[model samples]
Target: MNLHKILIFSSCLFLLPYLNIVLFIEETTSNFYEKYMSMLLVCNFIFSVLFWHNPISKSIIHKIDGFFAKLSVVTVFLYVAFIKDVDPYNENIFFLLYLFFISFARLSNKHSRKEWCSNSHIFYHFLMHLSGIFGGIVAFL
Candidate 1:
């Protein structure tokens, strides 16, 4: 079985809804959260393009994707802390960090990092991406 195909197919499936929402849906809004959410979802498109362009360990594209994907959690959850009232998301950052640590733990086997585009990495990555996007939508909306 070609893990690359699994990576590509699953990644696209994971992002297909986002791709439509971000691209085909015409909208005008002043909501900062919406704009920020859109921006975070855009990272998925970037990763898709980069992976398709060069699905190699030598490429640093995933790092870019990882950085933004991971960063979005922090940004999305930030407004909660600023809310004048008691905020449920006060613990969101810590929760996300905990989840990330769980995912990072998958790197236990030394070969995991060596593969770069390995299936486990791809799976864990999309899980993080899914968690961030879904969590943002649930919490912010």
Candidate 2:
């Protein structure tokens, strides 16, 4: 499939649970704050995926989204670190480093081919998957 189709498909896949979460929140809670926060999160998730289609790295929107991703990663680490007690405080540091690398990869897209090593795709996808899982768990709990 083409990149645009892949992006659209991925967005729809991510949106299912996202919408369910929002609907559940709306049904369970009356507070506008929580409701709006959940909506905002849904929007963020959609926009994050949309960033892949940005026209240029130098675009303001691209930089803003990059900053936003960094913010989300930090927020997830902090939530797990101090609030949820799901992981050690030191884990936040490691997460921050990982976030840095992700941002670097997204922003720079520069790295030696030698750096891929033997399990480059495996390791990269694994970490990406791990972060999403960690973030989801932290967000839910």
Candidate 3:
């Protein structure tokens, strides 16, 4: 199938994780603040994916969603490093973030303003979500 169809189909896949998060995550974390923030970050990601078809809204959505996205990663790192008193490096946070960096950089390239982007762009955004989910599962669970 085409990348556009693949991207939309992938968004539906995220819903499973989203439901899992909402249903089971509240009592898992020690900190309520962090738990809610992480949930919001995931929802933002799902919304960004759902709304990505709109060219005019793409940049705006990323601007809003991306802030929370980057913030969530950094916050997760900080929670691991200071609050949990563990070295984030031990968990390979940088390695996880590399995918995010590459994905964001590629998606934000000059071609991003167009109604559509290369297949790589769609794939990278999808990877971004996967990395986020994997990183969260590793760090939190």
Best by lDDT: 3
What lDDT would candidate 3 get against the real structure?
A: 0.58
Q: Candidate 1 deviates by what RMSD?
A: 5.1
Question: How would you encode candidate 3's per-residue C-alpha lDDT over 43-141 as one tens digit per residue?
Answer: 655665656555234466657656766676677666665665445574667445655745655674533455455676666666666665555555554
lDDT for residue 24 in candidate 1, whole number 0-100: 56
Ranking by lDDT: 3, 1, 2
Q: 2 or 3, which is superior by TM-score?
A: 3
* Clash counts for all predictions: 0, 0, 0
User: In angstroms, how far off is 121's CA in candidate 1?
Assistant: 2.7
lDDT by residue for model 1 (20-135), tens: 45665556622565556566656755685567456665358857765665565566556444532324563565456446644644552243576665777656655554554445
lDDT of 2 by residue, 1-141 (tens): 232333334433434434555655456543443344345456556665675454244567657655755555565455545554344554655566557556544433332144322244324433453445344433443
- Cα displacement (Å) at residue 105, model 1: 7.5
Local lDDT at 90 for model 2: 48
